[model samples]
Target: MIVGTAGHIDHGKTALLEALTGQAGDQRREERERGMTIDLGYRYAALTPGAPLTGFIDVPGHERFIHNMLAGAQGIDLVLLVVAADDGVMPQTREHLAIVELLGIARALVVISKCDRVEPQRVQEVQTQVSVLLAAGPYAGAAPFMVSSVTGEGIEPLRRALLAAQSEVSQRSREGGFRLAIDRAFAVAGAGIVVTGTALDGRVQLGDTLLLGKAGKPVRVRGLHAQNQPATEAHAGQRVALNISAERLQLEQVHRGDWLLAEWLHAPTQRLDIELQLLASELRAFEHFSPVHVHLGTQDVTARVALLQGEQLLPGARMFAQLLTNAPLQAVHGDRLVLRDQRAQRTLGGGRVLDPFAPARQRRSEARLAQLQALASADSLEQALPALLACDDGGLDPQRLERQFNRLRSSWQLPANAQVIATRQGPLLFTREHWQALQNSVLEGLARFHTQEPDQLGPDRDRLRRFVALALERPAFISLVDELLAANRMSSSGPWLHLPEHRIRLSDADALLWSQLQPLLVDGAFDPPWVRDLAKALSVDEAEVRVLLRKLGRLGQVHQVVRDLFYPEATIRQMAAMLLQLASDDPVVQVAAFRDVLGIGRKRSVQILEYFDRIGLTRRVGDRRQIRADNALAQSPGQ
Candidate 1:
């Protein structure tokens, strides 16, 4: 567990750490000369052998070093909020506590350091002041533990309390991918490049390759050390130091704010959708489009706030907003971060990343804002999804759904029976209610077709597709029909598709016409003539044969390629199969080749080739053609 020290400057933060750990924090020349922490200082304390191992991040208490403190606070499990007994609460003390709250550090042990310098009564007064300040925050009623690093007074009690606070911190899940924000990076004499940060999740093993950034080159881990020990692997919530080979990478290219993780999980983006929280004590409201410095993970970058629902956010107001960053951030969804003024001098507010890789234009829309709000407040992706899919009539885009999971770094398992409707525009999401509505639409359309066209077996698959607004793609429609058929909800015979519950029986006059028409169509075979020839062959009027053939076309028995030209689907399939076979053996089969195979005239073969090209069944190259696919029988758009 990682614990951080936060309070005013020179308030015995370093001294307390040294007393507990029995070593001065980061004994560097600059720190000894200046008598203050210039950058992050790290040291570890073993409270108990059986208890969890603990590490302390002693941050600079001075106001100017707040950014440095944030760098260390990113992965700490809890904070030890320090305040000097003699001085009580000072400017930096308040700022540091506010920062701790902004960073979403819920667990803390408030300590009155330097207790030896003040009287017992003074310590009581200071403790009261600290309690009153924390009254409205997450640590309300958390009693301050008085301690003096100068002597051993209250030292043992503080250690016990720190252990208890650390126990309360829930461990980060050790699943998914690993991400480490590089807080410290430099080159050692002969060990190559060393970078240190807390591993947020998963494990990073020695010799494993990790992507440097989004679309970044791969880097191999030459060696690794976790929790100050030479270890083979590291897991979540542990301080890790990685030794990377410096053959191709430059020192300047490795810096704070860059992230190391699996390539698929690296979604570096500039725009973010957030659920913002403004501090109630701020003097003014959070104005829209106001430039601010976003302290995310270990990196601080300039960004502007875009109020998603309104023009401004009043003090203490919680709302949905967008952060437009000047530089890319490696933050994921649900990562807590603070927002400061553009100059990096004041804390404006803080928020959680909702959509870290959000699109710019879509985020500004009102419809999207509602979805963002629902997702922001959800406890899990499963809880947020239904409302998210309900935002648009069209199903949710896969890319949009990924933002929620990627933002939270969640497991990507989808729920059962997750309804998805494929459309020409894209995949449209459907609720259970909507799926039911679709089933009704199909059954009702078929019933109406039966009522209107009594002589036909069912509606043409193409006609039913149009009647339903053509919302589903052809493939999706066919899949739905197949599913219905498997369930015995629908049935099909030859060219006809129909509900299993419905049937068509021919009338006396229609029966006589069908008997003659069926024979005429069968005798014509592969080279079936037009309606004119059918009427002459059957000794019927041309207009009457044309009307009867149209009825046959509705039954799915015949296919009409052009005006006055019709053939049974069986004949077309036979001709298509032969053409495909010829193209497979030959380089390219032209109309002449197909004419010879079908033993048909030039006009008929040319018409068939042109039809094949239009429907994506064949590709034309100069005077020759080739088969595009082998699915000529499944060419119904309505299917």
Candidate 2:
């Protein structure tokens, strides 16, 4: 379990954490001298025997470093909201509370620190004020404990409260795609590089290769630890320390905002759709397209906000908005964010991310805004999957879908009876309705091809690709084709593809043409006449001749030579026989001799010889032809 500290500046958040864990959270010399936290700090607490170890993230409480606080808060499983009994709720305290609420932190233990500094009556007064302030926050009804880190008063009660809160703490979603928001990066003498963060989703183990966001660099996990003890694997809600084998990276280079993730899981974007809520106590109103500082996970970015409902947003109003930023962010849907108005220099509101990687836009329609709102409210896979499919302008990539819906895929146990089409080009998600429609389209295409070219085996694969491309604009259409093949609804042979029942056949006219043309191929030197000439000879119309020729070509009963000339299978066989006979008598045969032996003119002779050369029957040597030594005919006797 991961616990995060939140409170106002100089409220002793780090001190309380140190007293609880016996570890100094503040490692910076300046922070120790100045007596204030300027950066994120870390400590660990050993739970009662038989309980899980707990890790704590001590965050800065100063308004200037609230961004750092947000970064630490991103991966915490539970929050420890600290309020000094003397000062009660301060500015940063409220801001931190707002951030925790937006981050969807539901389990918390409110701490009223510095109980020794105030009289009993004053402590009671401060507690009352703190209670009222938290009444509307995430910890509205949470149990508030009084503790003095200096004297360790009420320390055991605080521990008991935290342990009790653990029971109400909801288990992390175990199935989502893996995301690790890096908070601490350092170098180990012999271990190379190491990073530590709370594992947000999925599980990670030793030897797994993870991809760093944006950079796409592959890093191998050499070791893993949980709460200072070496472990083989770590799951969601656990604080994990990963030792990477790559070249050691600088602390600043890795930074707090970077993410270590499963390869190809998500793409970074500079825009997001968010459901925002302004605090009731905020003094100023937010105008449309106002500039603000946006903080999510561990990254701080300047964003221009586009209000969804109106021009001026009043305090405490829930609204949908788009955050457009110049810096790219590595985020996912359902992530939480904090926005601060640039002019007011005060934390304005908090929101949940709807589209983590959305395109930048100035003007959007009501329908689109409604779609974003729907996505924000989606809770289950059934609700979310369809919305994702609908939003995918082109077909989604199956590999991407598998990764994006990782949690859903495992828990939902998607039925195998449902057909999912995957093409080489894209993954097309199909509900039962979409799958049936695709089946109907494919059957119809095959039926049309059969009616138009009955003698042909089926449609050409290229033609089918073109047809599907025209019907489905997204890459997912290819996935549909794969589904058809897997279901045995379709079959492919060479460049041709068809429904299961498709076959090749020749028409009566084509049969007659084959019979008439077969005997003419005796000498292996005949150039069949053009379609018009064949029509005149056979006493048939030009269209009839063309139909017969096309059918013959499809059946492999004839070979087209140039535009109008053709040869039957028998012609090719006879040509091969004559060439074999000539090659048995001499190592080489001149083109003229071969042409004379075949009793053909120079044009037809050159064509036949070229065909032989193409098939490795003979090799061209300048103006002459030589029998290919590797040819099977060389082993046979014929002189």
Candidate 3:
């Protein structure tokens, strides 16, 4: 369990910590000279034998160092809100209490420090004032504990209360990828670089490689100390110091706001959609697009708030808003953030992040707002999945979804009967109802296409994708088309896709022309003739010959490799088989290997390979091509 001290400057926050742990606070020369805490101080104690250690973070109480104080507030399980008995409730004391309350720190032990200096009546009066302060907000029932660091009075009782609260500290699950917001980084003599911060999620072991910061530089964990003791591994909910090693990595590259994270969790974004609340103590309303200093984790960046619902947010009111930052920051859903005025002088309010990767357009659309509302209400990824799928019309990106929840893919609790469509990019998740709607749209679209153009076989895959008029990704749309084809609910005639019942045949005149063209194409088999050559051989007009061949191309009798060049349907199938056989041995089929396989010249092979790419028979990768098994032409003729 971690406890943080919060109160006014010179209010005995550091002195109380010193007395509790028997460790001196205000260690810095500047702090000692001034008799004040200028930065955060750390100490630990084992309240119970054979139990985990209790860590203490004594934060600076001066308003100028509030940002420093905030850096230590993260991962705290309980707050020690201190108020000097002589001073009663001071300005900084109220501000510190408000900041903790806005941060959603519910467990607190309000302490009236320096009780020895004041009379008994004065101590009681301060206690009564602190009780009233706690009576409001989330800490309504919290009681005060009076203690004096100098006299050792009420100190034992406070220690006993903290020991009892240990059992109540809920352990954070170490289920996701490792993440630690670095608050301090420096170099040691022989240990190389060392970084200390709170482990936010997952676990890390000695020798494990973690991506450092937004650059995703890989670094090995040489050793670590968890909860102030040397350990081989460290998990979430503990204060940790890691000795890391990497090639060419310097102390300058690692900053206080940087993060040590699992490789896949290194994404940083400039925009965040959050559920914000303006502090009731604010003198003015929070105007939309107002400049503010956003503090999340240990990083502070400038940003402008974009209200999702209204032009301004009144004090004490909660609303969904988007924060646009000037610099990128690492964030995840449910992470808390604090906002200060543009000048970075005072606290305005804070909120919990709802989405770290917010879209740039249509962010305030009705559907998007509904999705944000659902996200705000959900307590976990499991509860949000269904609601998100229902409200998100553009479908869910599986990678983004996993990152939003800070959950590993293996640990995701997917909704029952959830449909995951395999795409080239990755898998796309959809609910059954949405999946059905997409399928219905495709079938209905084909039906309308048949009605509009009875002469044509149907639209090709690319055309059909556009005709559907939906916001489906190309890979996802292709997967849906393949699913429909495999189920016999749809059919593909070479490059064209249509309803299984819809078929096209050549007219009588075109059939006669095809008869003359068919033999010529079959005879030329491997090296087909151009439209002009075929027209010259048949003693027919070039335009007439081209028109007839196009008709046959739609009927799946011949393949138009190019605008003029054509191949018999049988020849194209033979070429597809040869490419597939080459892919069977090695998925990447080079132009040279394919030319040898076809026993054709390099030019002809290149032409055919380019044509295969156009018809989706293969995907080109630099000088090679990968045969696509999902393509209709790649299948055997019997199928």
Candidate 4:
């Protein structure tokens, strides 16, 4: 089990660890010279001959080095909150306790160090202050003890208390996959790279290949040490140093905050939708898009909070928000994250990650906010999954789900009726009922479109996707469309989708409208009028002209020059051949050359040239254009 020491700088936090473990935590010369820990330090202690070892993470207590402290705070089974008796409770002492509270560390023991410096009454006064502070916060169960590294006072009792707490600390379930949040990394003489941290979730043995992140290079564990002794295997809840083979990997690639994963889950994500808990100490309300520093398991990243439900998050208030980070983080559900000021000076607040891979769109809906709240309240994967899928109607990415919950890969179960949509990104899950609803929605949309035009093919994929209220990623939506076509529930032609029974039909009214609109469009081919202008020329309402032209365009009778402009397909093809021939001959088809070849005025020539570029018939470069025959083939009708 891991025990992290927290207190003010120069307050004997490192000294207390050294005295208990019989080794100095600060191994660096600078740390020894300054007499303070500037980074994370590790030491180990064995309470008895046969008892398991207790590892201590000695974190810097200085306000300037709080970021370093936070890195060592993750995965701590118990907290040894040290306060120097001479100084009582200092600023960093209070801040570190706040951090411990925010991180949700359940077990703690406040040690009033330097009992030798002050008299017995002075030590008693400091203990009272510490106890009073703990009583007011989440760490109220903590008991304070007075100790001195110089005199060894109360040291045995402290060890005994920690051992008792160890018995009560829960064991990490081995049911989940392996993941280690690296807190330290360095190169050794023979070893390529060594990363140290507490193993979480699953077991890893010698020669087991692990991934540094989702997309990181594969790393082979040459060896491992548990509590400073050689060990063939390491599992969740144990502190370990994995000797990574230098022959296979460069030391520079591994860094603190990178995870040594089982290669089953993808690398961490930068964005997360979380339930942010603001500190009551902060006076200013947390505003939307507010810039801050996010500290998670030794990783420090610049991020901004995008409030999901409100414009401002008041102090001490909990709100659902999205944290957009400048760098990626490997995290899962229940990972505690602290938010600090952008300057990295003050702790603004903290929060728990509700969904590491939150939907990037439509997160503000009332249903979504309610779902996030449920997720925040859920204590286990079994309780969270259904609530999550209930709000995310489009579907949840399976890889993201794996990253969000440690129990998901094994014991955590999903709904019996759920189905998977395989996409390039990952598998998306939807309940059978939801999938049926989606299929019905698609069919109804197509039926509606068919009834409106009757002379046109069904709506294209993009148009069909717009009918769904939820915004799904493009690949997942495409996968669903493909599934429907494969199942014979829908039919597809090119990029369009329709029910199998759907077909284009023309009524007498539509035929008359087409007869009136066709000649006018084809005659105005060289300088086709905009839709509104065409309606004016034909002595008809623009809406009527729009309906006729929509049918005409879908029937392959005309080309949409742009949104409002329409031209006959025949006119467009003739122009395409002219442009291609000019580029093929000269290699540089300029506007002047195009104008000369088409024999149209400058304005019409510019419009037509841009139109060709927009339609991918020609590529533009330095006032010139080149046509790639392959990509340009499908863009031009009749090509």
Best model per TM-score: 3
Candidate whose lDDT is highest: 3
Error of 4 at 179 (Å): 2.7
Looking at model 3, residue 126 earns an lDDT score of: 87
Ranking by TM-score: 3, 4, 1, 2
lDDT of 1 at 43: 87
**What lDDT score goes with residue 85 in model 3?**
95
Q: What are the runs in model 2 whose C-alpha is more than 4 Å off?
A: 247-252, 307-313, 359-374, 386-397, 403-412, 415-418, 435-471, 474-639
**lDDT of all predictions:** 0.78, 0.73, 0.87, 0.80
| Candidate 2: RMSD to truth | 10.2
Decide which is better by lDDT, 1 or 4.
4
How well is each residue in 265-359 modelled by candidate 4, as lDDT tens digits? 65568779888988887889989999999988767899999999889989888888999999888778888899999899999899999888776
TM-score of each: 0.71, 0.68, 0.89, 0.76
Candidate 4 or 3, higher TM-score: 3
lDDT of 1 at 445: 80
Model 4 segments more than 4 A misplaced: 24-26, 213-215, 246-253, 406-411, 422-426, 460-463, 466-639
Worst lDDT 10-window in candidate 1: 630-639
Which tens-of-lDDT digit does each residue in 603-625 have in candidate 2? 88887778667545678999778
Q: Which pairs of residues have clashing backbones in candidate 3?
A: none
Off by over 4 Å in 3: 48-51, 119-125, 522-533, 559-639
Winner on TM-score between 2 and 3 is: 3
